[model samples]
Target: MNNNPRQLAFIILQEIHRKQAFADFALDKYLRKNDLIDANRRLVTELVYGCVRRERSLDAIIDELAKKKSHQQNPDLRIILHIGLYQLSYLEQIPESAAVDTTVELAKQNKF
Candidate 1:
């Protein structure tokens, strides 16, 4: 499995969506299994929890911005969007370009 923080966040969110897994449990499981650096581990935790906490607001923005509603979009794509938007909107330290580029790259990597 990919150890990149964003990639790991994607997998955790996918598990939450598909299996209704608890965020903390899934995150802890992955964090324990992977030898992520402190910063990377923090990023993964922030991305997963932030997305979950802000899901409603994110979906609202997504529905307004996308041609398709959030629920109508592919689940993985929606999660990717959430990751990007969370970083862009909440993580002031992250450059907007990096957020957009990484999120787009994730979508491409997933063959979306």
Candidate 2:
């Protein structure tokens, strides 16, 4: 799997959803284990927690835009889309291009 912040966020989401893991615990575990730089660590934290916080709304959007329902989408792709949509809708400081590019890269990695 890819190791960029976006990819890491997707993995964290997968752990939370698939393993029924606590968001904070999964995030902290990955943060500690990965040796990510400060910016990436912060981004991962934001994406993981942000996605968790806004999951319902994000899924609503996913349901509208995606051909497949959220549950039917690849788990990895769902998480990646969550991160991308979260960044687009909530984190205005992030450039749209960067968010879309990273998310697309993540989807590609997962063969979405």
Candidate 3:
């Protein structure tokens, strides 16, 4: 499957969730398999690590914004939201609009 950084991040997140895979291992495996450019690969790495590290806080934001607990969400949707929120909340260099738009597209493309 063709994957942008956000899409790749979504897949990595799902792998982590479903397989209970180690976050670093899953991210590295996927990044190595994909043809993503260096920048996108870096973004995917950051998103995967950031989401895993801040999972509790990210879920809290999801809960507050969506009014649904993370466990209550579709797994893909939860992961997408976490990626978007992580970028928005932590990555000062990324524009807010880009983060949100890419995240929404990732969800739509994944049929979430």
Candidate 4:
């Protein structure tokens, strides 16, 4: 699995989505498996929990901005959007460009 915090968070979110897994459990599972620095671990935890907490709001935002509604989007793509938007909307310290660029890179990495 990728060690990038965003990528790790994305995978945790995907597992939550596809397996109906609990967010905390999935997050803990991944965190245990990956050797992340404290900051990266916090970032992964924040991204996963924040995105899960704000899922409906994120979906609404995606619906408003995307030609495809959130539900209509590919699951992976929607998760990627959630990661990016979560950072943009909630993480004040993260530069907007970093969030957008990293999310775009994730999409490319996944061949979306």
Candidate 5:
């Protein structure tokens, strides 16, 4: 679509969060449906799987960061936290500011 890699990742995360679909299946289906090519397709692949794999730990970090006793947030916020923390913990090549800003923006846009 018109969105960048990070934005696409965020949208995919939301879809996975909302649809209750398997991340791999959803990502694969999405990849095949979209016009993503070459490295960007690879980025989307990594983005989806990486975020899904580390979802629990990401939730813990986000709960801690938000100073909460537990992760009792909405599913959309869960998606946001998962991607944000995935980038924070693993995607070291991407700047932390970009990750956090985009995650917050995505959450806001989704009304999370």
Candidate 6:
């Protein structure tokens, strides 16, 4: 697949936050529509849920670092950062730079 892992992860996350979509439904839809392999799809699912579950903590960090209200800040950047920070905080196998770069790229893509 041309799509990278983090990009796929970002998509799942975006669907969660923007659509308020459920994890199973969102993941199933993405898997049916996309060409991602099972492994990457699993990563997407995991990252999406993991980020969502930790949202309160993420919001705290965003509030502390960016000084913006959670509802007022750009959703795109927030999701991007959520996914990135999730990886950075929990995904030991994922390199730190990849998390930062992927989130920044997602932010740029959304013009945030």
**Runs in model 6 lying further than 4 Å from the true structure:** none
Q: Which has the higher TM-score value, candidate number 4 or candidate number 5?
A: 4
TM-score of 2: 0.91
Per-candidate TM-score against the hidden true structure? 0.97, 0.91, 0.93, 0.97, 0.78, 0.83
lDDT of 2 at 72: 89
Encode model 6's per-residue lDDT on 2-107: one tens digit a residue.
3566676677777776788887788777777778777886777778778888998887877777767766777777777788778888889889998788778767
Better of 1 and 3 by TM-score: 1
**For candidate 4, what is the total of clashing residue pairs?**
0
RMSD of each: 0.8, 1.7, 1.3, 0.7, 2.3, 2.1
The clash numbers for all candidates, in the given order, read 0, 0, 0, 0, 0, 0
The 0-to-1 C-alpha lDDT of every candidate, in the order given, reads 0.94, 0.88, 0.88, 0.95, 0.74, 0.77
- Per-residue C-alpha lDDT of model 4 across residues 10-82, encoded as one tens digit per residue: 8999999999999989999999999999999999999999999999999999999999999999999999999
Better by lDDT, candidate 3 or 1:
1
What would the per-residue lDDT of candidate 2 be over residues 3-47, giving only the tens digit for each residue? 588878888889999999999999988887787889889888999
Model 4 segments more than 4 A misplaced: none
Collision count of model 1? 0
Pairs in steric clash, model 4? none
